[model samples]
Target: MKDTIKYVGLDVSKEKIAVAIAEEGREEPRYYGLIPHTTEAIKKLLKKLGEPSALRVCYEAGPTGYPLYRLLLSLGVHCDVIAPSLIPKRPGERIKTDRRDSIRLAHLYRAGELTSIYVPTPEDEALRDLVRAREDAKEDELRLNIA
Candidate 1:
């Protein structure tokens, strides 16, 4: 049997996520509509995608944080957070939209043109949060001293 891999690309937003799925060696990708950016919506998406072993998912890293990545990892889906700038742009591809972006990502990922960003573990996240909070507290203290 030939190796089959499904590539799922997601354009994540604050309120919703646009998804596209493409099987390796396939020319056309299937588009999944905008889904709410909530835990329930993500779970529903996983259900629709079926077994994790059958798909490899990817999304551009943005302000939404790593919640989706963490959630997908916990559920056994191999997920990657790709840097937006790492995706190649085709010249003369004038129109740009969520659907197009998602489709592009799917294609790039399938072609191995996407480079994934680093995803810190839970411990790393906690440490980073703690450091940021400490920095904010120190800034607040300095402001009070000047006042």
Candidate 2:
């Protein structure tokens, strides 16, 4: 049998990550539960899910940043940093939870409805971080002088 692709959705946060998987075909996406937000946990999850070549993963872009995306890419997994605001929503569907988000992401991703954002190179990210830090420091200095 030909290998079936698995579209995996991850709801990532500072402490944990919620996971869901949508296998090829029309089956409803299933919640795969939560795991600690760490490299080891992610590697374990990938192993449990099957081959990296068969896994397409995604998560919303958030303050927790692109490290997870980078990690997945390094592991030979196709990963997307989804624009959260652009994720499709049903009318009046406001209830939000990590599990639900993961499931929705997986389903939408499988349907080719989710948009993947451009991920910057590590060097670019470092430069951006440096610029932001400098801006914050300047703001703090101004605020101190005003006090």
lDDT of 1 by residue, 68-113 (tens): 9999988899999998887787788879889988988888889899
Best by lDDT: 2
Q: What is the lDDT of residue 28 in candidate 2?
A: 100
Per-model root-mean-square deviation over C-alphas: 2.2, 1.7
Candidate 2 Cα outliers beyond 4 Å, as residue runs: 137-147
Q: What is the lDDT of residue 140 in candidate 1?
A: 100
lDDT of 2 by residue, 1-147 (tens): 667899999999999999999999999999999999999999999999988999999999999988999899999999999998899999999999999999999999999999989999999999999999999999999999999
**lDDT at 32 for candidate 1?**
82
Query: Which one wins on TM-score?
Result: 2
* Worst 10 contiguous positions by lDDT, candidate 1: 1-10
**Model 1 segments more than 4 A misplaced:** 1-3, 92-95
How much does candidate 2 score in TM-score? 0.91
